[model samples]
Target chain A: MKLSIDRQIYSDACISKVVYWLSAQYAIERTLDGTIETLSISRNDGHPFDETELRSQCLRLLNDYKLRQTIDDETRDIRTILYAKAFADDENLTVE
Target chain B: MKYYLLPFKFTRIGDHEVFVNEVGDMLHAPIGTAEQIVNRTIEDPELYKSLVANFFISEIRIPALLDVYAERLAEKKRFLDDYTALHIFVLTLRCNQNCIYCQASSRDEHCAASSMSRENMRLAVQHMFKSRSQYLTMEFQGGEPSLEHDLFLYGIELAEEINQTEHRHLTYVLCTNSINLTDEVMATCKQYNVLISTSLDGPSWLHNQNRGKQDSYEKVVKGITKAREILGADRVSALMTASELSLNYPIEIVDEYHKLGFTSIFLRALNPYGKATDNADWEAYTNRFIEFYKQAFEHIIELNKQGHVMIEEYAAIILRKLLTPWCTGFVDLQSPAGIVNSVLIYNYDGYMYASDESRMLAEENDFTFQIGKLSESYENLVYSPKVKEWSKVWNNEAIAGCSDCALQAYCGADPVRNHSTQGDLYGFRPTSLFCKKNKAIIEYIISCVIDRYDELMPIFRNWIR
Candidate 1:
């Protein structure tokens, strides 16, 4: 169920593209049946709230979810993109 | 060994540089050494290459040496073979809002019928069509073009009719406040394909501070939203006039544009002339605008990695010319004097100025470059000695730093702006307010590209190739 990135070149400032890919990978990992533990990560503990209860107290998208939650073991496009951004100043992107 | 005297064409690249053939795409020339004759002469390699390229592409040796990069060399040699006027007539002197640094002063409430006569309009349009140039563009500008709605309508109709009948490629553009764009006006613009440009000095608080009859920012945003819905975002654009207040918080301007969904920004520096000449505060603001421009361009490029496609006009202009073969048609960038020679101005009274910023120099009936009246034909105005003077400066203006600077390749010594600030056409601006700001901005820009180059390589390659 992992994404195939062999033919696809990775690394860009494409945040939306990366996010969507992450979402898809998360879904695919959960649907794979063996990765239930990875998909269960959350920033906020589930709790009930009243109108006065600040919305910030409730959880939203989990940022620290395991990589296996999105991509299969073989796919590294998202990782490549992140690494590229992190190490942006060091490399000459043009193959020349 | 250097034979050619004045008009030096080639610059030395490290020890025998190469270029691609004529008429090909701006295809990257694969670097390779030419099989030269086993040389008996001893000389510098870079200088030798420069000389060889010149003589190779010279008129005397057309067939053999003029094989690669030759036609392109010729094209560059004759950059402005066609001189056409992208005439923008400021149709009205009347504007509703009072902006603090109003270059076209709102002081002239005595509206003077504030509109071009039907007769003058007819003459201007007719003169436009009669030109033998490849492309003709007519842009309508004003305190607010929409303020003179009937005159604008009249002028647009004339432009459309002439283009249809006379059969010339025409680009019709308008700069307005967007306050007066009614559905009728929008419909006419849509039908005729008029590119609409508006002004937004900054965000709500700052914009209202600078320009307000009513809440100017909301009004401008309303105008942009309404017009963009009608004319489409691609055809609708905005410009900013920087003031001291917005200088420190330049990101606010960029963020404001982003909030409004504009994909690009001119980050226009405030002019130091016109009613604004007294505003010494604007110099500080201009510097701030340049600083913000560098930061915003970097931020936008970073965001581009996150999937946003944004370009700053200043960066975009340099990048377009440096990386691509197709020209941006910016007036100042071309080699053969690109002022009144490339674009001219016809004011509302059929009075002409050689450059747009000419009348902005002094106050109370004192202006510099009222070169001719619009009643004169295009041929007459273009060939005038005033224009000849500007064209001569096309090589290197009488400016101080620009004429001698190494980076003149990437900059424009605007004599018109110089003439506006100082008493001379080649104003003492290298030391003045404008030059300091540009030097800082240009150096900062070069650093940014050179710094985070790894992140840029992918994007740069895609754009260049």
Candidate 2:
């Protein structure tokens, strides 16, 4: 339960995930304690994606890298596992 | 199928997820092990990812997530019940100068008869006031708004009269050359509380060359200084254009504004219409113009760093996109198109142009924006099938680059500009020089302000707010 990885790995994962949700133009700023303090982008262009899930996935991706460090896990396999179910349920949306 | 992962944190309570803002910031929430949710998600793999891809990026709008998701971006944008047009009333196309790249300049004096008559001007004003939108702006444009001082005065008084009599809320402005800012004109403007805009195409030589037959440089500097003296600094500002000769002296343009004490400069790209198309060849590759913009803007930002307090017009517009979640009310950036959304252009000849650019195109016999006429009822002009079709086409925000760009939400691409310049509602080459020029400015501002930025956040927020 005390699963962890180096701050460097976590940092890389965090960067990758933020870059995932945002282009290089955005990121989640962190406090000295390494806790996320803000989420921001580089431009005012409109965003239509879910901010909550985007953040959640970004964190999840970081944890996945951490999990790989602690367990006998495949990073590629975990990424696949995380995204596999996205297609079929992608359409279950409500229009305004 | 949910499997626990490590090292990541999520805003969660037990197993439930939390929403984030446009910037990824979340309100205070109890932290739960993202590991647990990942494990739980892993157990029922398809269910979790499906919900996610749907909620996060899919084209469909998921109902259960609607209120929550909409709230996340509500800070950046709002759901508007109605769209408005940006009315740019071209009071007179009879410009004093025969500049090579004057987009609205007359190709010949043939258009001298095209000045908006007093009757049409009154009708246009009446219709604009009677319109349903609470917010409005009436822009006086011309060979110089001051040149037609009486008609310009009549237009402003009419607008103010309607403002008090009909209880209409509107802002009055004029785009003019500094050459004609007589004391009488200034008094009329002050009485009306009008915002006046002018141009300074750089130092004397450059300014004189394009402005025609007169001492343009001295004229603009003096006029602007006088207008500022009388109108107060807040009401007067200027725009710059980069023509062929201008490409060689971009910094001089910036310097000219600084010497005159302007805090903002609009480095407007030339719209290739009207007199400009004939002179487009006067400038070389647009890439050169990009170099001009890039250098001028980057230097201006450096000046801002040194506390000179200058802004590149294009950059400020782009910075608003990079820094906020909403669109600046710039007419050029509107979708459903700002063309007919807020303002309709009534040409001097009594025809309605969808946008000012459309009027320029009219020089080539193209009348895409001639939606109606002052001779006709204004109500019928706005609600007509032509207006609807144009608005519909304008509103269908579906350019590939725009839809996919990270900054799409921050921008309102001007289809009218694109339609006039590139001849398409959605230009496939948005990544081309024109688009890159816009994008680079955003890139530069973001590069400059970001978290290392402490002072500009207020202005940045104001831009989008």
Backbone Cα, N, C clashes tallied per candidate: 10, 43
Q: Tell me the spans in candidate 2 whose CA falls farther than 4 Å from its real position.
A: A1-96, B1-85, B107-112, B279-284, B430-434, B447-465
In model 1, the Cα lDDT at residue B3 comes to: 27
Model 2: per-residue Cα lDDT over B208-280, one tens digit each: 8876646777877788888989999989989987777788887788988888888888887776766667654
Clashing pairs in 1: A13-B305, A13-B306, A14-B305, A14-B306, A14-B307, A15-B306, A15-B307, A25-A70, A26-A70, B21-B69
lDDT score, candidate 1, position B62: 26
Fnat for model 2?
0.00
Query: What is the iRMS for every candidate structure?
Result: 25.9, 12.3
How does residue A12 of candidate 1 score in lDDT?
A: 19
Q: DockQ scores for all the models shown?
A: 0.01, 0.03
